[model samples]
Target: MMKFRHLRYFVAVAEELNFTHAAERLNMAQPPLSQQTKQMEDDLGTILIERGSRPMRLTRAGGAMLEHATRIW
Candidate 1:
């Protein structure tokens, strides 16, 4: 079962595309937020985020998850 918190975190990261800002927006530390995102990616067995890009790039799956999660709440 997936946690709604995880989805919320995911969407935040997706929208902000930067962990630092996203973490600030979520009122949490950046490391945990990034860890949560990484955990989500691990759980889904797919790479959600593409590194080495400014503002971070969302993979196709990442975009899809963002859209879906956004609709969840």
Candidate 2:
């Protein structure tokens, strides 16, 4: 089962594409934001964001999940 908190974290980061900015928007620290994203990926058994890349992009699964998540919220 996935947590709503994880989903919120993911959506914020996915939209911002920057942990620092996402963290600011989420009103949380960057480390925990990263951790929640990792937890979400671990729960789904797949990679989501491509960290440390210029113009970050989401994996295919991540894109799909974001779509569903958007509809969910």
Candidate 3:
């Protein structure tokens, strides 16, 4: 079950492009933030952030999600 917080967490991570920074911005710990973001991916059945990359990069889907998430936020 996807929730609004999933989008909010993802948006923070996407905007910062860094999990640590995004977690800090969101006033939460990194592990939980990472977990929620991963859960969001699972719920959507699509990769949003390229976790394997250094500094991270948003996938095409991620960019589109960010656009919508930002508007909603």
lDDT top scorer:
3
In candidate 3 the C-alpha lDDT for residue 24 amounts to 98
User: Against the true structure, what is each candidate's TM-score?
Assistant: 0.93, 0.94, 0.96
Better of 1 and 2 by TM-score: 2
lDDT of 2 by residue, 5-69 (tens): 88888999899988999999989999989988998999899999998688888888889989999
Per-residue lDDT of model 1, residues 1-73, tens digit only? 5688989999888889899999999999999998998988988999889967885999999989988888886
Better of 1 and 3 by lDDT: 3
Total residue pair clashes for candidate 3: 0
> Candidate 3, residues 26-57: lDDT per residue as tens digits?
99999999999999999899999999999799
Instruction: Give the range where candidate 1 is weakest over 10 consecutive residues by summed lDDT.
Output: 46-55
Candidate 3, pairs of clashing residues? none
Which residue runs does candidate 3 get wrong by more than 4 Å?
none
RMSD to the true structure for each prediction, in A, is: 1.0, 0.9, 0.7
Q: So what's the TM-score on candidate 2? A: 0.94
**What C-alpha root-mean-square deviation, in Å, does candidate 1 show against the real structure?**
1.0
TM-score of 3: 0.96
